[model samples]
Target: MKRRFTVSVILSRCSLASSWIFYSEYFYNYQNEGRVEWVYGDGFAHNLNNVNNLVSSLRFVGDEDNWKMDSITLFEFDLFFGIEYYDWTDNTQVPSGMSTVGSLIITGQNYWTVYTSTNFSGNRACLQVQSGQYVGFAADLDEYGIFTVRSYRRGCFGDKKITLNSDQHGFAVKARE
Candidate 1:
């Protein structure tokens, strides 16, 4: 039997017009820092499905524009909610001017609703039961600061992820065989 592994991320920094969210792709027990070819344009939010490439280290690149981290402490990610913060030990959170989007991870048997825009608006999806994965929309992603995850039941992925080939960014939930 096959199992579906999925993961998602946001910029986390508010004002960063562009940024890079890195993930360590893995398979079985082997993994690497970041080998995934990122377009890195306006950035991207992806829900990876079952595949050979699994993201392990989900990190937000804050210094792309060469902005010095003067005294602004990284934004504190909500302990239990949309923000995954995978293996982020050193410094967790971005400066005030920067805020990346976050994914609402679900587990067990609770319903989860995620909005492309905050307050639940513009292109939305939900997971009720079984194994369901929601891939965020690219167009709706421009809202910024609005896609904050609202979950009644969820948790962050420990060390596993699956992604799709995103060009226009579509959604598909595959069943294990």
Candidate 2:
């Protein structure tokens, strides 16, 4: 019954970092046209000649001089489109066919908090990225009801900064140092 990818930390300067730091991998197909497939850390999506999903364009290599190492990609369908689960650390349960998370993407600098209940508790949403921009895409999160995300973690549990909604795709609620 060891269904983990699990994590449980609530502020107090929550901790959990180190997934083999290495920012900016590679994957291109369309406009970026031609061969270029290089991703370390994590697993899956090595289509090569077949080019599994034929990624049109991609680039989310965390650690732009260290943004908490950066990494977070979860999509089971929505604007981001089906099947994809990447991580950097922190999860109370999520990594087995990925329960449900429609769409979400964030890279570098830090910001993440998703819980529908698990070790992190219930009903919470905060995903940030937009200050010089590294990467931050929500695509669709059911208007913030969150489909089913058991638990998640990265940064921003609360201590100061706040920005719930706005342009360039908003989602912010940071604090914890």
Q: Give the Cα-based TM-score of candidate 2 against the true structure.
A: 0.26
RMSD of each: 17.3, 18.0
TM-score for each candidate, following the candidate numbering: 0.24, 0.26
Candidate 2 per-residue C-alpha lDDT over 69-169 given as tens digits, one digit per residue, 9 for 90 to 100: 56777766444443567787888877767767676666665678877788888777767766755456665677555777777898877433423222222
lDDT of 2: 0.49
lDDT of 2 at 48: 28
Q: Rate residue 147 of model 1 by lDDT.
A: 47
**Model 2 lDDT-worst window of ten:** 16-25
- Candidate 1 Cα misplacement greater than 4 A, ranges: 1-98, 102-104, 129-177
